[model samples]
Target: MRALVLLACLSVSCLAQRPQPCTSPALMTGDLYVSTQSEKLTAFAKYMYDALGKRIRLREVGSYNNKTFELDVLLLYRQGVVYKINHKNSTCCKKRLCTKFHPLEIPENASLLGQSVLGSSSGPGQGLLVNNWYGDLQMKKGTAKYLSQVTEFGCVPVSVLYHTDQSGWVVTSFYNNVIGLTDPQMLYPPPFCQDARLEDEDGEDPETFFSLF
Candidate 1:
């Protein structure tokens, strides 16, 4: 009886350590910061995301090649359209969205690295508990490996790192101030994009941009 009990306890411990799938809130609004290790590009954006409705919108300010620019990106999966608007010049480029909407969720096949506290654990509510997960994602041209950290309780994304053959060594995104979506209209394209010019077939690929989310 003692040996049987020990074995049962071990089984439970193993099961408890297994990685569990987690999904973000269906509708969320947050601030996103993106950086690339191989490029001198960095962006900060306020974003609205609707995982269930397949819509996303971002108002971003980014610096690249010593140039600063403000841009807006709107992705509507149902309409299969992506609008990239330059806020500085009031130019908009409408492009066909090639990729499907991928929700911000820990993939089922992701391996949990472990869990850690982001701050002091000495007092209650002093720190945030986060889970780390790693996985390889199959992309159109190559496989991209990713590491993600999210809040343990609500599965809110804290940060994500991706390495892809085309995208160089590393691209990381940090999420902050995530909350449930407040305004539904935030997901819609701006009025200035109504007369946006359609991008050429061989123009900037939307697939590479959408994969970040």
Candidate 2:
């Protein structure tokens, strides 16, 4: 009787656990802070989630030592903002538990600060508007422009919201070159938009996709 009970206990211990999705859309978000090792991108995906395993999921997209690439980072996110803190080989996200998060501190000014204000425009806009670049690629051409900016003393353009008043971010992508911003709010995230492995413009999914970025 003891042996039979022990065998059953072992079987239960080996069972796999399933991940669940958010039960509601209550504006979910994450904070991130990252570190890198010799070009090795580990904390690449800095989005946080519930300890219960439902907030974020990672799928290997592709790689790059040099060159522009794309990926499939399908995240059904519902939250405030994803702060890509720091730069270069690292990007730290901010969730409730992140240690580096700090509130903005700015002096209040009422006198003339040499600023121009204009009424908001209502119309369709152009350019990319995604946040949290995921997927995979070993770019021989571009670097983690955003992280690299803070890493190597360069500036990276990060999209605040997908041109909307709020929707948070759509995707984080990379472009071969930099884009200009008229409204800080309309700026594009460092690189341009990227497609996922399965969502590549060519629509080709590698037989075996592995991520080392």
Candidate 3:
């Protein structure tokens, strides 16, 4: 009878204990979307903030030959970060496009750049360029090389610069003169980018990141 009583007490004590509970659920944390230096081009700015390891979809508000198309970018966060200390740059464009030299305008129907900067003054975000009329991209240093063009809205002194070679376009947005990057493929976010909008989210440093599988 005593053994039975002790067993009963032990059973009760075991029942009183509870399994360990999860302290917290894994969550993705990032800053809320904020306006970058350029007011007209905030979408790209917002993208830089939310694009880490996620996908990006872009739709030009205007119509092209009555045919509207959307651009998709898959952002991969990387390890290295672009921290800009201080930089200065000046951009200029010819009223007449140098398109004859640079025929590589992304989204052929999209004319969001005529000419612009190639790299960002600070941050992985490329610098600014002067654009006008149709957004056709022209190389910096008056070269005849056309890269990519960005067609967002903003009248800030400088324009965003999007460029690529064999890879796809690397979009850059500016806020308060700050620069960031947004690449759907998780391109190498420049290590010294200041703009939060242009950094690659999926693969901040692709090599450092490992897959669970």
Candidate 4:
């Protein structure tokens, strides 16, 4: 009976230390930087607190179709509610979207990228674990230059930079093929907010965008 009791206690302790699912944008707030190794993509966010509520302003830039693609996103979290305003500009189009949703909809792996940061300490619940599943990968001869564009392309190195308690800031990089797939809500906002958008000349041909993918 004593051994059984000890086992139960140990199980409870492990459960308590498990990294909890990220149900709050607050976990992702503050100053954060995310980027790809090739420097083709980069994002920065600054969260500030004031009398009204906590607001996170974000800016991201990348290259598409040999042109620059940029996004400005503003997230407001108040009273357990999340509100978002995002503007995107690229060679294909310019879009502005707004939406409101519950934080519970966000997956734990969405913003818990700190886990893959290189040289970061890990304990019972420091970072969440994610799996990358791939199947049916095909390649053609003389297509070596286009491998990076393949949806199931080779793995790439990604890094997440964050502020630490003792240290000023730290960076960690890891291999990822499906980086943001876990965050569907974040990748594409609600459809209602997608109306009245502006399309660039190249937007007419979506294939031009997918060809690179």
Instruction: Return the clash pairs for model 1, or none.
Output: none
Residue by residue across 49-161, what tens digits does model 2's lDDT show? 22132223222233333332332232222332222222343333333211221111111221111211122324334333221222221222232222111101121222211
Candidate 3 Cα outliers beyond 4 Å, as residue runs: 1-60, 70-72, 75-157, 160-213
- RMSD (Cα, Å) of model 3: 24.3
TM-score, every prediction: 0.83, 0.18, 0.18, 0.32
lDDT of 4 by residue, 38-93 (tens): 44334343332121234333434544334565544434434322223443332222
Q: lDDT for each of the candidates? A: 0.77, 0.24, 0.28, 0.32
Please name the candidate that would achieve the greatest TM-score relative to the true structure: 1
| Model 2 ranges with Cα > 4 A deviation | 1-28, 33-35, 42-48, 57-64, 68-213
Cα lDDT tens digits for candidate 1, 1-213: 999999999999999866587998888887877767756567788888898889988777787656776767788999988888776676778998777788888999999899999988999999989999999987666788988898888888888888777656555555665567777877777688887777766633322234454
For lDDT, candidate 1 versus 3, the one ahead is 1
Off by over 4 Å in 1: 1-19, 86-91, 195-197, 201-213
Residue 186, model 2: lDDT of 16
Cα-based lDDT at residue 193, candidate 4: 48
Question: Which runs of model 4 end up more than 4 angstroms from their true locations?
Answer: 24-56, 69-98, 102-117, 120-213
Q: Give candidate 1's whole-model lDDT.
A: 0.77
lDDT of 3 by residue, 1-213 (tens): 999999999998886542211111111111112122223222222222222333222221222223332222223323222222122332111111111121112333334324445566566456654443233433342212222233222233222233223212322333333223434323333333324443233412111001100
